[model samples]
Target: MPQRTVDTVIFDLGGVIMSNGKPSDFASRFPEADRERVIEIIMGPYGQDSDHPWHRVERGEITMEECRSLNRDAIIESGIMPILSTMQPQGQESSSTGGISFNFSLSEPMVQLIHELRDNDFRIGVLTNNVREFREWWWPLMDFETVFDTVVDSSEVGLRKPNPAIYHLTMDRLGATPSRTAFLDDLQSNVDAASALGMHGIRVDDDPSAAIAQTRLLVQL
Candidate 1:
């Protein structure tokens, strides 16, 4: 494959190469009876904003109890019955499992592509807007040191996407100059932020196949 100008590729973990299609897609997996309500509770007007429980969870500032409280409040404010069935407690000391559990299953194709990139001498890294406790769920599934040259978890650094500082941190850690790095993210704002820093930026869409195609096109792989 012909090379693009970028020397390093930075991917957002959730939807770029992982099997998570979209955050809202999970609502469809619930029982039909709970579908509408769950979607409204997790992906509706309150769902998209930064003040939501999920947002706070991703940021790692709030405890699990605080997340549930926020979730309950979001549901009630949306005129729906509150259900804490999917809320999981935060912190290692807690033994509750009422909140959503995040799972990141890498597609075989993505895994192969990553391996190929490394074999071809490309530097790879991950910059995700993940919870502080993300390693509790991800470490067992993937090799951070082997699969990625560097990882900048937003929660660990206290800087989330659309914030240029986070992206700058990633570039610094990866030793990649902005002109030599390409960033892929599920959100347009995140991509735009990367672009502002002089990196090639690609927005991942809902379809995994489409996202993969976009990645290949951008990388010229």
Candidate 2:
């Protein structure tokens, strides 16, 4: 067999390995008219890591409760709180905490692909911009230790995607060179960041088939 150009594969968790629960997924649940604004307030600018409440939470600088308080204040100030309140179900009580919940399921095809890559001796890792509070809920969805060589969670590491430091850190953990690593993420900005750093970055869409195909090509699998 010819030499493979890529030996390490890095994945973003929420939209790539997990079927749902991305920030966009949460925004999608809101009415179309309010979706974009809701996403902006709840997730901030995803392409850049700043002191936004959500970003701070992901970096472990703030607890989820504090993030929720900040979100509530922002929402109230935006005057959208009343609109959101009116959208609640007639019988259901509104939650005072401006918190978002995520329910995610493993992406079977991605899981299978990971196992195949492992069998082929390619290193696998996860680099996710995630909340500390969400670990318990999403951790059990996969046999992470058995599949991935390393799992880098932003909250635990105090860094998130689009911040070049985290990507460098992940590659360092895997003992991987940027040119020999393939990174897959559902967000274009994250993918672009990795690509800018000389990693072969693949953008995953709602349907992951294209991204998987691209990755296979990159590693010559």
Candidate 3:
């Protein structure tokens, strides 16, 4: 079968391109119900919504330093620290900002995959719910100019994943419509949001191979 032709491809940054120490990743640290409870506190209302402080940090509404301080204080005040204590790895240090350390790293073949797409003349764009502080560390790791046509960071734009507005902002900036662009994210909720808005949404979990495979199938790359 002839490959479907796509001009624009949007990639999610965190889980898709890099790893982050997410609270959910420590589920084994707590007992079943306890882990669920901790996760609920961490995510809060509107899970991953702009209203969340973590989202605020992503939008540049607060500095990472401040966020860390606030999160620790809140956890302490709320008595969440005791539970988290059990989850903390021995000798493992939490981020100075009082959260798990999450930095962007180029996932091996995923980097190659992006290059392959670019080499094939696919216009690539990045859409990420990222903090402003990330740019200080993330850019030096990879040559983004060589890889993507545009990037929309939530901290820079004040919009985030699962929000229809943020996706529209990216598509408009990339000058792409939903059908013409393929969107890959590590979260189903985000993929669903993109799909709802007409983008070809490919959902994956932490693994970029799923995204790579889906992209190949979608565009016959």
Best by TM-score: 2
Candidate 1 per-residue lDDT over residues 37-88, each given as its tens digit = 7765764432233666666666677755566666776666765543332333
Q: Which has the higher lDDT value, candidate number 1 or candidate number 3?
A: 3
**How well does candidate 2 match the true structure in TM-score terms?**
0.90
Ranking of all predicted structures according to lDDT, beginning with the best and ending with the worst: 2, 3, 1
Candidate 1 has a TM-score of: 0.76
Number of the top candidate by lDDT? 2
Name the candidate, 1 or 2, with the larger TM-score value: 2
Shift of residue 53 alpha carbon in model 1, Å: 4.2
lDDT digits (tens) for residues 21-40 of candidate 3 = 34455333444447666665
Q: Which candidate, 1 or 2, has the higher lDDT?
A: 2
TM-scores, one per candidate: 0.76, 0.90, 0.80
- Per-residue lDDT of model 2, residues 1-221, tens digit only: 99888999999999999977677676665554377688788889988999999999999899888888788877767665433433234555423223333457888888878888999999999999998887866898878988899999999999998999999999999999999999999999999999999999899988998888888888888
- The C-alpha lDDT values of all candidates are 0.69, 0.85, 0.72
- Native-to-model Cα distance after best TM-score fit, residue 164 in candidate 3, in Å: 1.0
